[model samples]
Target: MKLYGSLTSPYVRKARVLIHEKNMAVEFVNEDPWTEDSPVIGRNPLSKVPVLEIGVDSYMFESPLVVHYLDHVDGKSFTPRDPAGYWQSQWWQSLGQGIIDAGIARVFETRRPLDKQMPEKMQREEQRIHRAIDLAEKTIKENSEFLLGNRYGLADIVMGVAMQYTDFRYPHDWRSRAPKLNQWLKGIAARPSFVDTQPPGFEPPAA
Candidate 1:
């Protein structure tokens, strides 16, 4: 198995962290999609990273799908079985993806030429991020340790990467506003899975 993506991508980092936690034997293929001739196009026309080559000519694109496959590989489950627990877990997963999406938008908007950048759109994305953080804090307050009641799962992984990526690509003054969320992140960051997969220049917040 092979995974192609850039190290700086939070989407790719999600898969990498899970692969580490499961000790999955998958080769990491470093491919920068920005290059003129990125190999990512060969497998994923969208030129998205975190594409998993599971078999000959068989590929899975998208971070959440790649993560779902990894989580279920080897008959192992990274989700709760009960209907309520499972759905809530899924909700958290969706919110985490949404948060990352908004963060990515903010990142690319800033990268645009100063004259072409849309300040209004950037503000909207920034607002989305802040709202997501508030929701995550509320969920953590109810869900207890981790995002699902102390049972570290895939949702937590996605959320963790999203938060870390925000810090790396879009620094914000959000930690103080959401103290519970901050505490949750501190514990998640200490995990070997998280520590080993951090992107270049990522510094964990002091606890």
Candidate 2:
């Protein structure tokens, strides 16, 4: 199996975490989708990061699908096989990933030259990001440690990737404001796979 994606992408991080958690041995191919040479375009027409190719045949794109498929393939169960537990993880994953999209957009907007930046759009994204963070923090506070039930499950993994993205892109402000989440993120970061796979530096994807 092979995974192709940029290290900085939160979406990529989610797939990477699942691979590690499942102890799956797969080659990690570094590819920048923005570049015309990127093979991601061939596997997925969307040219998105975190595309997973299974063996010589099947393939899956997008972080959510990649992780979900991985959990399914492992058969050991990262997600609950039951309906309620399944839906809970699904909801948290959506909320968690929504923040990632907003964060990505916010960063892109900020990277633009001052004259080209759209203040209104940036403000909207920033608010969305904050609300997402608050919701996550509240969930963590209500649940003791993991997002779902007692053990760390799909929900934790999904939110973990999202929080990691926040640290990689936004850093100080959000981290300081959400101390408990920061602590949780620290624990997640301590995992060998996460430490090994974290995106290096702050380079932006090519236009």
Candidate 3:
């Protein structure tokens, strides 16, 4: 399997981290979705990154679906098999993905020329990010160690990558606001999967 995405993309990072955690053998193909010549458009009509090619004429887009497929193939999915637990995990994943969406929007908005940038849109995205941080703090405080109860599963992986991306792009002092979540991320950051997949020039500084 080949995963096509940029290294700095949080969505792509989520897929890459899951692949490493599952110890799956897959090729990493760096592709910029913004470019017209990108191969991602061929695989996905939406022209999104993190498109997983399983076989000839077989492809999977969307980070969650790609991760789900990988987990299904490995037979050791991080998401709970139980219905209740599955939905709970999916809820957390949605929140994490929400953060990723808002952050990416903010990044792109800021990249635009000052006159062309939309302050209102950027403000809305910032508010969304703050709301996510508050929600994450509450969730982690209530459920110590991981997002879904005590297990480190898909929810935790999704949230962890989202936090890392925010830190890289926004550079906020979120640790003070969400201490538990910060510490939780610190532990996960030590994992080989995370360390190996750290975005280029965005790795956490030495303690």
TM-score of each: 0.96, 0.88, 0.94
Query: Candidate 3, clashing residue pairs?
Result: none
Clashes of each: 0, 0, 0
Q: What value does the lDDT take at residue 207 in candidate 3?
A: 25
Predicted candidate 2 versus true structure: per-residue lDDT over 29-130, tens digit per residue: 999899877777889999998889986766799888888888888678788778998898899889988989988998999999999999999889889989
| Candidate number of the best lDDT | 1
State the lDDT of candidate 3 residue by residue for 1-207, as single tens digits: 999999989999999999888888899999999987877889999999889999998999999898889878867889988899899889889998999999999999999999999999999998999989988888765427777767788888898888888888877777788878887888788889889999999958442
Off by over 4 Å in 1: none
Estimate the lDDT of model 1: 0.88
Query: Where is model 2 poorest over a 10-residue stretch in terms of lDDT?
Result: 198-207
Q: Cα lDDT of model 2 overall? A: 0.79
- When 1 and 3 are scored with lDDT, the better candidate is 1
In candidate 3, stretches whose alpha carbon ends up further than 4 angstroms from where it belongs are: 205-207
Error of 1 at 91 (Å): 0.9
| lDDT of every model, 2 decimals | 0.88, 0.79, 0.87
Q: In candidate 2, which residue ranges exceed 4 Å CA deviation?
A: 55-57, 175-177, 202-207
